[model samples]
Target: MQIIQSLSEISGRYRALFVDLWGCVHDGVHPFPGAVEALKAYRATGGKVVLVTNSPRPRDGVAEQIAGIGVPADAYDAIATSGDSARLAMYQGAVGTRVWHMGYADESDDGFFTPPAILDDPLAIERVPLERAEGIVCTGPADPYADPSEMRPQFLAAKTRGLKLLCANPDIVVDRGGRREWCAGAYAQLYTEMGGESLYFGKPHPPIYDLARRRLAAIADVGDASILAIGDGPQTDAAGAMGEDLDLLFISGGLGAEETGTAIGGSPDPARLERYLAETGVAPTYVIGTLR
Candidate 1:
């Protein structure tokens, strides 16, 4: 990995940037000082910023959370969320319409129950019993502070029903407010292990990237060579960038930080990170301690 101290060293190379939200930009509680400033600085240089996230909320809903967390609108040109892609799939009946939603009642999971956009073929997304449901839509755990084990029973039941799963957020875990928490991807993995088919619509998946590319194209005529993906998750961010054939700027923080002996929100140890990257076989175009 080419370890850099700040994004300014290479921000000018990209015309469009795909930035992650949860850990790279914010910790689900407050915006990172360096991350916020980095986005603002990148935008100041005429770079079109797209807030690409695995959040299980619509663009507007995610924007509301971003605003609430004090991330100014000037930091990003557009937002593309997993929820947006999931909703589009649901609307197109890619994954059946009638679904048994397995998620918290938070607004982030609202796309499963509410259709904010006009559907060409309107059909009620009725929440029925697990046995009667045609498919399962999993946004995340029902409790914000719960572990993946807490949802084992629900996932097993859904698996037994032979229902397919449509996971909005493919993030297994996230560092929310400096605390580690399980996400929808954890439960989806469990369901898949029990022989249930799952379709994920987030990082490491193509659908979410397709949606993000559209948002980026709307602002500027940029290609893969002119786009950079920045995030903290190796499996999600790095993997997604590679799959999309885009360059990546990996931040040494969040879930995979421990593998490289790097503390969350702390400076990275290059030697340790090199070993970790070699073992994982995941490479990035650049590596930074943080966004700044």
Candidate 2:
């Protein structure tokens, strides 16, 4: 993979960009000014920008959350979220009607329960207790800071009942302002390891990529060859892009900063980056320290 300093160096090669949200455009708590500017600049060149995120929040919720953190609307043309894709599946009876909801009780994840507007005759879902439910819908753990092993007992019960879990976000963990926290994928991984079935609709999975393509199609008729997938997650973004046969620009400074020896606003150590990529078995088209 070729290492570049800025996106402008290769921006002319693609017609659209499938940019990741967390760890690319924002740090969850705030926006990355350079990333935001880079997106705006790309859009100015008549290129489409689709914010493909694994956030469990719906599209509108994600838009609001990013706006609250200073990520302007002009940076991207559209958004496609894993929550929306999973919601569509849930409403289509991927999971049974009576489902057990596993997430924060503070109502921060309330938007996940909303039905997608595209579904005309959506299933009538009911949130019942785990023992009485037919399936489970997981947005994330009730406490992101806690270990996923703590859910073993609950996962065992669900497995015994043969309940299927619909995972909204497939991100194992994300750095929110430099503080790493667990995500829904970690819970799903643990559940699956315990013999429970977990269905994912996020990055590294085909469902979310389909949704992102539809979002891009609504704006312009762009093909897979003209799209560049950009993100920091090797397992999610890199894997997803490879699966879809799209060119990828891997940002080594996000999750791989420590392993790549990349300082803030600085490029990664060439030797370290090569070693890291070799270990992950991911080959991206380009590499950048940050989105800018």
Candidate 3:
């Protein structure tokens, strides 16, 4: 038999929590109702919480953004970000190298100093060239790079030069506004499909989970079966929890934005909810409209 419980009851079972950052803790625009309160209460009761995110931003940068939006830095035990994983991949290589970042280039990469010859040019494979590149950092929307048939011309320029692809965000798709976007993952997937090697990090992968696990070990380590991971998106979050072997709680409004309309007294109608489920094929352990 299945049972439903409130936020407190859900979090009560685990001594340590590995929470997804954007959807579970706060919406992109603001903090979700009861998230902060529930977290503070959980920590006060000696439960450990760690904020795990795939924002492509460094952990410190993510922390600052969370602080700007009001999730206390102390509320969570540790942060592990995709950017940090990307940096780790680079660090695995020799220093003072040119790694063409073919994704969303954050201002942090350029501001404080020069780190790896970071470039955001999608066409750099032809113009600037990747032959001399120490490695290739892929995190770009490939559709804009051109149709799949045009892949060889764009990236073969890099491969012709023997460039390795380092995938920062291993997410195949991300919900942007309300649509599923083709990110760097699509490109990396294509590269490997064509027999090119790639290093993957972030959701639905093991590296990010191992990192989060090591961090969780210091503060707390609850059995995986007892830990619940609440998230909004299925492709990344729900699938990620399944990949990590943890329980899942799905939020309906964030990445599942298609159902935000036609409120049934202020929430998505059941028909719309069914539509989203049918469309995404995401089955969560718990389905909730909001944190409150």
**Residue 30 accuracy (lDDT) in model 2:** 85
Which regions of candidate 1 are displaced past 4 Å? 105-112, 116-118, 263-266
Q: Which ranking of candidates, highest TM-score first? A: 2, 1, 3
Candidate that would win on TM-score: 2
Give the clashing residue pairs of candidate 2, or none.
none
Q: What is the lDDT of candidate 3?
A: 0.65
Using lDDT as the yardstick, the better of models 1 and 3 is: 1
Model 3, position 97: C-alpha lDDT score: 52
Per-model TM-score, in order, reads 0.93, 0.98, 0.76
lDDT of 3 by residue, 135-225 (tens): 6776555353344345666577766656778777766655543345666677888877766677777776777777777777877656777
Candidate 1 lDDT over residue span 1-292, tens digit each:
5888888999888898999998888888988878889889989889999999998888988888889999989999999888888877776665576778778755455445567465666566777777677888888877857766766687787777777888888998898787888888888887888787888899989988898888888778999899999987877888999989999998876566777766645667878888877876679989887777
lDDT score for residue 119 of model 2: 83
Clashes of each: 0, 0, 1
Tens-digit lDDT track of model 2 for 1-292: 8999999999999999999999998898988759999999999999999999999889999999999999999999999999999999999999899999988656566477777788899889999999999999999889889999998988899999999999999999999999999999999999899999999999999999999999999999999999999999999999999999999999998999999999989999999999999999789999999999
Which of the two candidates, 1 or 3, achieves a greater TM-score against the reference? Answer: 1
Model 2 spans > 4 angstroms off? none
By lDDT: ranked, best first: 2, 1, 3
